[model samples]
Target chain A: MKIHIYQIAITLISSLMIFKGFENYIKGKNGQTVLKLLVRIIVWGGMVLIALFPRFTNILASTIGMEGNINAIILTGFILVFLMIFKLLSAIERLEQSLSQVTRNETLKEIKKED
Target chain B: MTYFENSKIFIVIPAFNEETVIQGVIKEVQSAGYENIVVIDDGSSDNTQAKAAELIGKMAFRHKINRGKGGATKTGIEAAKLLGADIIVTIDGDGQHDPKDIAKIIAPILEKKCGVVLGTRLLNPKGMPLWKIFANHFGNFCTWFLFGLWVTDSQSGFRAYSKHAAELINTRADRYEYDSEVIREIHLHKLKFKEIPVAVRYTKYSMGKIHKQGFINGFKTLYKMIWGLIS
Candidate 1:
């Protein structure tokens, strides 16, 4: 029945993020796809649940056949971080290619103007 | 000389921040009987564009942002193609490549011996730094491993492309890996390519340029080549 300071902090942060995600979805910012919005909601909602009820992680760990809840949480956090990093890298590479193409086309267009 | 008179040879010099030597490099290419010079200033913060523009007959195109050497070279190639270039020769803007050898590299293309002529410095690497020689060989090995085609100097920027070859070899790399990509294009398209010995001038100024590919860049180029293959 004891509520720790860390638990309150995490719940507050996750709730704020969840509210912001829904607000953006309502405002149609970044062309928010349904699947993207669903994923964001699931991730933030899961964090809020875990912060509010630390015992939920024990159930998750048992379902995943893990001995300890801390190990399960750490492993899932690492996987999520790595997936986000990979996605960001790929996106950056795509943006770089687009920028190069635009610059190249503009330079070539100047030749046509001169002729 | 008569062959050059018949062909519209465009000398493409892809430069980035080479303000001190752009004019000299332009003059050298001009003195070597190549009047159609296209200098692609790859978003240089210095006076490279202004210096190149000072030369009346040469064409200077500026990129709104820096896109590395490969991007600049590709832009230059595209511009040269639009300008009706029959034979396009790409040279470094740092004056490291001798404009005198332009005739030698383009001879094979002019004679219809090959669609692409690669100027190899390894054939006669006199006055070339020892470390550069080693790095070039490593680059050649990496190119062979990644693309399954090998040349003496896969990293050499001094090259000549016939109109047909230039039109066919469309590369996607926007960095140093572009040279290796050209080799891959040659392999994939079955374009006839000839490698000939060409002279390289390594001066204090060229050696001092920060943009030159060093130990770290070589690995980065290799990584990009592999990533291109996978993605």
Candidate 2:
């Protein structure tokens, strides 16, 4: 099978979308945003690596980072999109956690009988 | 003529994450002589199923994930109808509705005064939050405007449906909007339903866990109701 640049680009985009969605789903389940910066740092580091050394495609593929010269560029784009989704999901998780916590505290306080 | 006698009147309580009140609601409802009461636990992470099971009822159901009140309701109705309930009475599992009022909601249908009965809390909205008051009024007015008929309360969840009415309004929304959608169906199908005065007891606990997004979701509900009306 010829490793066509376009096919590799499409696969990279699709894989990035799946990974990004999976991250959001996990964050959503945990209902927390404390790791958003950590996620951004990792994502940015990966982007920097790809931007600086575009020829490192084969090495990236072996390292499970990325594959193909054209695939690397598409993946870089995909990673940027995923980062935005990660931020959004993390923000939502934080909001949900705070709201649920407030509601929980209120419920506990309401349970106390007034003298 | 007595379906409750020959066949059981399965009271279907559609609950959504109701761990806090399911047990109490189940206990109250179980005290009544009606056999074959089925409770649909709509994907509650809490002890809704366990609490309901402890109430000594015949059967209990649960959804793997939250599908809203409409999903739970459809589950209950389908189960009861499939279980051969002569009549199915849908009441909230939120504990705001009085189990004692169950008889009143179902009586009119049994006696054939109306094909369906909706327990209108028009007189007892005192403890209800202000937003709900406004939303319900808006709903009532919209329903009246569209149907060109008078309905005291359009968003009351405490209601009764004959097997026939149940069969007619088989489709239901998968959200808190079921109440209004059902009313729209009742109007469109030309099915007769009576709005009777029933006392509603609202407490701080119950009020805390109600549909708080009143007017914010009012237009959405209006849209759904109208959609149901047109379709």
Candidate 3:
């Protein structure tokens, strides 16, 4: 029942993150901000719980039918990275769309000048 | 007989670093009696824009940055539409495509046989490189797989489009994959497509360009096609 120094530090940091998330959520003016803040709090809270009670990961692994906690963590991490990549790709797609628009507009202007 | 004399046909030449060939292509298109010609310079570092600019009173649009061939083609098409073009024929700025074929390709669309006229190089692949023939067949296979239609040459850049077909074909591919994407768009929009046998001359320069495009570009286009379909 002895809590490690590292666990205490991680918990404190996670609590601070959760507090910041809540503050942002309360001050958020849009649905996107609120959703982002909520996700941040949940992720930080999960980190804190995992840091304090690492054995919970074993239970999660068992529930998920994984061989070990490491496997479960790896799978979750993979999914998080995958989702992040998809989000980044969507942003890139938007940028590409705007770039194309600008390119089209500029070309149109040039054509007008010639005409 | 002047087939397209009454029709407003715009020849859209999309050029990228084709400083050596752009002027010739423009002159050839003009000499063929097609007055409505637009050369879209796709932001080449070299003198592509300058070469295109040499032709006085020609409609040329210059992109500020390199937006790929697809982006350039789209820009050229937009210019053609602005000029009140009834038929848009997209040809590469490279001198490989015969400007005379513009009339031949548009004939099907003019006759109301198809909404789009695709120039197929497979009919007479005489001087084309071996790699291009292979890449073209591979592209044809992909088109069949994606659209369930067997086309002779799906990746040929020389194609003719009616105003209806050109406006309806919406594609997001900004690179070499745009050719394949155009085929997919034609199928998705249910536009009637006709493939005509056209001759392509493969110079040492064009052969190098084709070899450079090679398999890597083909694979990239396939990946983009899949991405376009799902996303």
Query: In terms of DockQ, which candidate is strongest?
Result: 1
Q: Summarize candidate 2's per-residue lDDT along A1-115 as a digit string, tens digits.
A: 3455655565566557556656776677553354653554466556545544556666766567554567766776787887677567646645543543343233223222221
In candidate 3, stretches whose alpha carbon ends up further than 4 angstroms from where it belongs are A1-60, A110-115, B1-3, B56-58, B210-212
Q: Select the stronger candidate by TM-score from 2 and 3.
A: 3
Where's the lowest-lDDT run of ten residues in candidate 2 chain B?
B209-218
Q: Which stretches of model 1 miss by more than 4 angstroms?
A: A1-83, B1-3
Q: Please, what are the lDDT tens digits per residue for candidate 2 over residues B1-231?
A: 555577558788877677888888877877866666778777677888878887744467766666567667766777777677777888888887888888888888888777888888875776676767777787789877775656787777788888888889844465556776677688779899888777787777666764533565678767755654543
Model 2's CAPRI class?
incorrect
Model 2: per-residue Cα lDDT at residue B202: 78
Most TM-score-accurate candidate: 3
Which residue pairs overlap in candidate 2's backbone? none
For candidate 3, write residues A6-103 as lDDT tens digits.
Answer: 99998999899788777767776433376677677667777787888888889989998888899977876786687578657767866886898898
lDDT at B97 for candidate 2? Answer: 83
Candidate 3's residue-wise lDDT over B1-231, tens digit each? 555566799889888888888888889988988878888888887888877877835476788998888888988888898788889999988788898888789999889899999999999898887877988898899878986767898888999999999889987878887888888888888899998888897777766664235677778878877766655
Order of the predicted models by TM-score, top scorer first: 3, 1, 2
- Chain A: TM-score in each model: 0.72, 0.43, 0.63
> How high is the DockQ of candidate 1?
0.49
